[model samples]
Target: RSNKRLVPNIVEPKIRTIEETVPMADRTMEEILQEPTKGYGEAIVILEILAENFEIKTNLLQLVQTNKFHGFERDNPHTHISNFKRMATTLKYRDVPNDAIKLMLFLYSIEGAARIWYEKKPPNSILTWDDLVNKFVNQFFPPSKTTHLKNEISRFTQRFEDTSGEAWEHFKEMLRACPHHGFSELNQIDTFYNGLNEQDQDSLNAAAGGNLLSKTTREALKIIEKNHKFVIQEANRMFLG
Candidate 1:
């Protein structure tokens, strides 16, 4: 028969080993590049994806230590180091390796200063990221400045004239400046809501229709968005009248 050649292919089906059944885990960089990511701003979207992937891929890696940079600012070392610490802390939590952290720090620094600093380093001398951090801190922020920054952070509040969104941003910045401070969530919401303009506050209150203590900052923001439209429409009507 014409099909006789195919019929003699096997007496029984082959049994696959565990290793044979398992799919290959490795993927080419090209394959990853070919995958689509959704968002506005190509650079930002790609960076976000890379950051997320880095977090996942490096989750099991040991914490890699490096020399630290204290920070450098002649007039206000407190502000400089505060920003530096934020970046460093974020990277640490994201599981970034120390060597990469140093590179990132350098990349983020002012172009001319970073270039000069890199060029001035002793030839072939090893400086850890920790060492870099310390050198920066000592060079810029002394003990007195550090104390002052802490006091400033504790006393920070939104100015009465600042917009609700601006007030929220300032509040977040303050929290970042003093993360260990015992500021409660309820207080934070109250502070933000209280700082808003009277009209905006009324809109948020009406939209929420209950004690806003239960709502998160994000939820409050959504209520503002929903109510702000009516406020704007009313203002337009008054202007036309």
Candidate 2:
């Protein structure tokens, strides 16, 4: 399910120095907007140099190539067209600064490129652009019904809308001591869902209106529900006993 693109290793090309690579602030507004493709190329070159110097493992070349203002077709013709569409759509949603959105765009771009690269394979066999988008959307926004309980908890916390200093201090302490902990833990459920065996969790995920629950959380929820019901039934039996 990885969407990372493969980039070839090559010696770093000597071009502009890092300091000189920065975009100039003196340019006119129009010139600033159209500041030649050279600036973009130089920025990418500097990035490659820095990545190499730090031994950072990444597909910097693919990013540079894809981000460039040029038309370079892949071995498969359809891949070129699809990549263009994916890149355009990505720019459309670039306003949101959330990490989820960033990761989704990056993954979608890579997946789109991959789809083009693997277009010659069997009809049913490769990952497509639609698949990438579906996976990302499902990961970030689970079904309404499935997320109801978590939403309830969030609403409950927000009910005490006290902006006062003492209220803030008490709230912070309550947060620190709460068993469920911070708002971040709720987001981690998606990450946790990704770690489970796909077959075991996919069904429950579908039932919940897409695979929103992480495998661990899903399993824990099931166990708690079962145990609670069993305890209640056992208590009734004890009364009869």
Candidate 3:
């Protein structure tokens, strides 16, 4: 039974790599604004890369909200809001199929609206960047919205399955696998609980009276300030480097 045959070990074949070109870094914001269509596409590509590299969605959203494209002046808040809204709409309606278009439309609409809401000073409602993110996450992935989009995409994909059918099916599967559905509920609950805890802590501090800080607490505050400075420096390095 021993040494009767030699067996060959076969290595698995590598699948073809999909090479997605990351947008250029050297292009100034001005260059991007000059022709918004290409520039906006590049901007989105860059944003996606930044999100992946940094693993920080909040920071990425802040960067996008603050970015001033070429032909767009910085700190012109109105222009920035307008440009973002236009870009969002454009991306929503780009030559993609109807199902994809609808999904993009919903995403961009909520995110774009939230960005505008966040940029307002003395906002009618006190909504922070975190608030915006929380709201979008909730609305998009809620059972009602998610189920509707799923059914719409299912029907749309089925209708076109005969023409480039494989691509349509693959796209639908990708949509089904998106993580937004799961994260939406958790993020909303976390935000709610965190806010409640903060309010309770503040109330307790107020009830304690006495300058809201004893000598020990004052020393703790100093330590926190020092730590915050270091944290800021680290964040800057991570973001800009």
Which of candidates 1 and 3 is the stronger one according to lDDT?
1
- Model 3, C-alpha of 71: deviation from truth (Å): 22
lDDT of 3: 0.33
Q: Which ten contiguous residues of candidate 2 have the minimum total lDDT? A: 41-50
> Of 1 and 3, which scores higher on TM-score?
1
Each prediction's whole-model lDDT (CA)? 0.45, 0.36, 0.33
Q: On residues 110-221, what C-alpha lDDT tens digit does candidate 3 reach at each position? A: 2344434323322122123333334444533455655664454333322232222233334435344443334343332223223233433343344445322432544434
Ranking by TM-score: 1, 3, 2
lDDT, candidate 1, 173-202, per-residue tens: 766654344556665566667656676566
Task: Report residue 128 deviation for candidate 1 (angstroms).
Answer: 1.8
lDDT of 3 at 228: 39
Candidate 2 per-residue lDDT over residues 34-75, each given as its tens digit = 634333222111111222332212353345346432213223
Instruction: Order the numbered candidates by lDDT, best leading.
Output: 1, 2, 3
Please list the residue runs of candidate 2 whose C-alpha ends up more than 4 Å from where it truly belongs after superposition: 1-127, 139-150, 159-241
